[model samples]
Target chain A: MSLTLVLVQTLNGLQLGVLLFLIAAGLTLVFGVMDFINLAHGVQYMVGAYFAAWFTAMTGSFFVGLALALPSALLLGLLLEILVFRHLYGRDHLAQVLATFGVILFLNEAVRILWGAAPLSVPVPEILSGSIVLMPGLLYPVYRIAIIVAGLLIAVLLYFLVSHTRAGMLVRAGATHPRMVSALGVDIRRLFTLVFGFGAMLAGFAGIMIAPILSVEPGMGDQILILAFVVIVIGGIGSIRGAFVAALLIGLVDTLGRSFSGDLLRLVMSPAEASQTGRAIAPMLIYVLMAAVLFFRPAGLFPAAR
Target chain B: MSDLVSSASTSDVPATPRLRGTVALLVPAAIFLAFALAPLLVHAGLDPFYLSIVVRIMIFAIAAVSLDLILGFGGLVSFGHAAFLGIGAYAVGILASHGAGDAFLQLPVALFASAVFAFLTGWISLRTKGVHFIMITLAFAQMAYFMMTSLSAYGGDDGMTLWTRSTVAGSKVLGDTTAFYYACLGALILSYAICRCLVVSRFGRVLRGAKENAVRMEAIGFDPFRFRLVAYVVSGMICGLAGFLLANHTEYVSPAYMAWQRSGELLIMVILGGLGTLHGAIIGATAFLFLEEWLAGFTEHWRIVFGPLLVLVAIFMERGILGAVTRRRR
Candidate 1:
């Protein structure tokens, strides 16, 4: 409503955007490279948060918890790839979807059994615990800002890793022309495992970073998984740049829409009807955005050259 | 042995044509026969609750059959199929709330609403291919889910309960447990017949051709998109009918009816029965619901077992229960 509130909401949206980017980055890359649709990707995010919550409580240090969670997440991803996902690479997308969905069900329930149904909380470390004044009468949580910064840093680092290095070259090549990459005698299998593991680690990192602020709970990833799917679809399945752009776009649009739709609708209709309609329309804004984008550009904004 | 397995598992081109033909016809007939006689079994003191479960199975089987029209035969993996189900359920709920509790009125409205929704979403969704299509459908379904949740006038997130079942021409036939069971069975039979006919017709051939090779189908002077859209609409209508039955059976309607997870379960049903087989969808719905019910009785956290079982099915049971049965017989 007010300028300060709008500013705070925008920052909140950015934080959400970065977190989405972290999750979508791994998802899109795995999708692009392996052409494997891992529905369990969201569960990996949930697992990361669970690991962080458990470790943070055990170690009594957030940093140490993060350090441990990252590898654990990576190892879990690799183990899945080796056990369940590897066999699925040759199967159709439907099989991949079904298999991963099973993984989601398993992991979600397993976490519930392990951690119980109640949501777990991670205390904000003392260094990043307080709110900072952004401007006059505008204060924001430092932890959220840190998430945004961390996400951006990862994005930059991912950019360098994907675009500048030899492995990045292979990944890019794999995305565009996988058979060609394989024909050139690259160990496509190893590359797939690495990409799958790395993507899991990135998603895990996102989970670990956001755990302090958000409730670490079972099935938390399901909703965000849908949001991240919207991100990758809007971004173009295999394009990291597309995922980044789309993630921020969705984040901003979703946050701003939820916050402003009622006020905006009030100008055109009665306050009561506007509020009701706005409430109905706000949660659907991102989906509408996605449908419109796909309708106009079926392959998305930046379709990877396949 | 590996070659034999591969040959048997090739669902599209069955290795034993005559055997498969007989099995396909017999499976549906046997399934329907069991359904038809299920009420008698309940009447004979086999637990009336079991009849309710079968009724639920028939309702979901209708949904699964409709989904197989697109997912199995047409190769359009619509992850939002549950939206139509919710639309149908909500139609009954909303109309019933306003005192329009006639079966004739509720059925048509539910069917029409689902048709319109399917047409619009499918038109956009079919523009993309493969994974994009899947995600787009999911997004649209989420939109539907959110819309339903926002309807505070209609119970919102908590959903609403129907006071009584819909009256058939002002008669309370549906209120009777046996009559309702027959009604659901009759609807499932009718839906199965319609979908089975569609899949075998020339129209179905075009749909299947598109799945095999869209470019080739296009080159052969058919517009795959138009056929797919029509199929999508028909499929939506049937699933809506299922939703109508689901509401009547459960005496409730909620936003949860259209959740993405429900859509996923629908997909699982289609896949679990055996893709591209109408009867398989029915078998799948039965198998899935029975498994869930059976597992739930053992412990509260049954998904721990069911989840891994699904993974094994995906990894091992490529052709589902139907395929497994046929393979074993061979």
Candidate 2:
């Protein structure tokens, strides 16, 4: 393996990891705080991408598009929360699962109705479009590096806000004991609204950021949503820190596994057979990793609440 | 029905039968009988297409019933039950593609592979509770799904087509639509009966007890993990059987059959029919598939309507169709 290829792949893995963290942070929080399972969270990602795509196309400016799209995404999320999710809180997990599943079905089809089934793509902004040389004979895309930096910065900022701020403390407390938080005379409902809305926007932001590189289509978020679930499960639901670490871990594992598993297998066996087996097993390696994690620490590596 | 099963233990009253109990058992039996006799009565009138729909319903009903074995009765919500189904289907498809279409050999192979996967996944998944457990099972299922997608020798992403259905005593019986429908109906009824007996049995009592109060069950000397694990395996095996039937039913197996959406649909079948009720699985499958069929016939955007309807069901109707019916009787 050449050093340049390894560095490039590692950078790609980090970029992917950061994006996953952004989405998973919101997901784990919604899950931990409300004890609600939202399958439609992926659709919010889809919506964000679509919103960005549409706004960018209309105004011909990525920054302007994002400035307009983020709040709209947050509003849409809050609207859904008020109309549907609020009713589902305190219900059994089955109801939450079913209702959110319904939202997924609706939103996926709705997107298709609105944008057709063809995959859509957002153009990389002109300023961040090109690549920069990293090491001797190696170069990486500036946009992807930007994504990594932005994602990490968000993660650091989130840590500060969650661990050092009152809202973060309330969020932590609410995750463990919702009733106690309500009894403290804080408008628990407002807190939940902020949490849910903010989480949705974060997911949407990840979607928009990724739209340039990944295919933007209906049902695009479905697979990643499950992976995000894996990330949260391995990271501990409702813990942003856990989400960040686990998201990066899963992203690295999945990305690296997909890239090198065939080569790794070819070292031991004939090319054809190794490639076949590697192709078959590589995608599942992360899931195997998750299973191993859950087996040892059922609550995940860093559970935020009891 | 898990609700019926658990309510008996939770209520203060001992050994008192509610009216809803009788209806729960009877309503499902009637639905089963209707489907059982469907081919005989509609054989002359219905087209092959409609007959096949009923057969599809029977196949999914078997899967849903097996899912209820764990989700409804045991309260171990498994999002990856479709993995077992896919494993079973793929087993039959791969075997048949390799010229091993005999039921005796294919069925055991399907059951064994699915059982092993279930046991391994369940062993890890059952260690967690609530959302962790749900997500873990889902991840495991996704892993299986990815594996299936990578099996290029077996048609991989596009899916493998079975050249022929399972041969039973050197006959073409399964090739006939009516015969296959009856075969599936028979399997559904048999699985339902077995589930009925198993849930009321001593093993079942312990499983349901764990669902009600894991701490209490543990206190009383039962290891909820082992009991739930066994239930998970049994449920997986049952779903595998349904998968075997599914591959045989369509003579085609694809990764799409085991998609997470399929798992979600299976859960929908359980909840919509009335969770924890054995017959509810059948009812849910029938209603869900039939609704899809009817709605698709009416409009292309049926999902738009169906999604909101489901949210409404979750928000307003907590008990589901069967639960509502039974609750009113009480």
**Residue by residue across B143-195, what tens digits does model 1's lDDT show?**
99999999899999999999999999999999999899898999999998898
Question: All models, DockQ values?
Answer: 0.81, 0.83
Instruction: Return the top candidate by DockQ.
Output: 2
lDDT of 2 at B11: 37
Please give, for residues A141-218, the per-residue lDDT of candidate 2 as tens digits. 999998999999999999998989999999999988889999999898899999999999999999889988888899
Per-residue lDDT over B138-172 for candidate 2, one digit per residue giving the tens place of the 0 to 100 score: 88898889988998988999999888999886677
Please give the distance, in angstroms, between residue B200's alpha carbon in candidate 1 and its true position after superposition.
1.8
Interface CA RMSD, all predictions: 0.8, 1.0
Give the worst 10-residue stretch by lDDT in candidate 1 chain B: B14-23
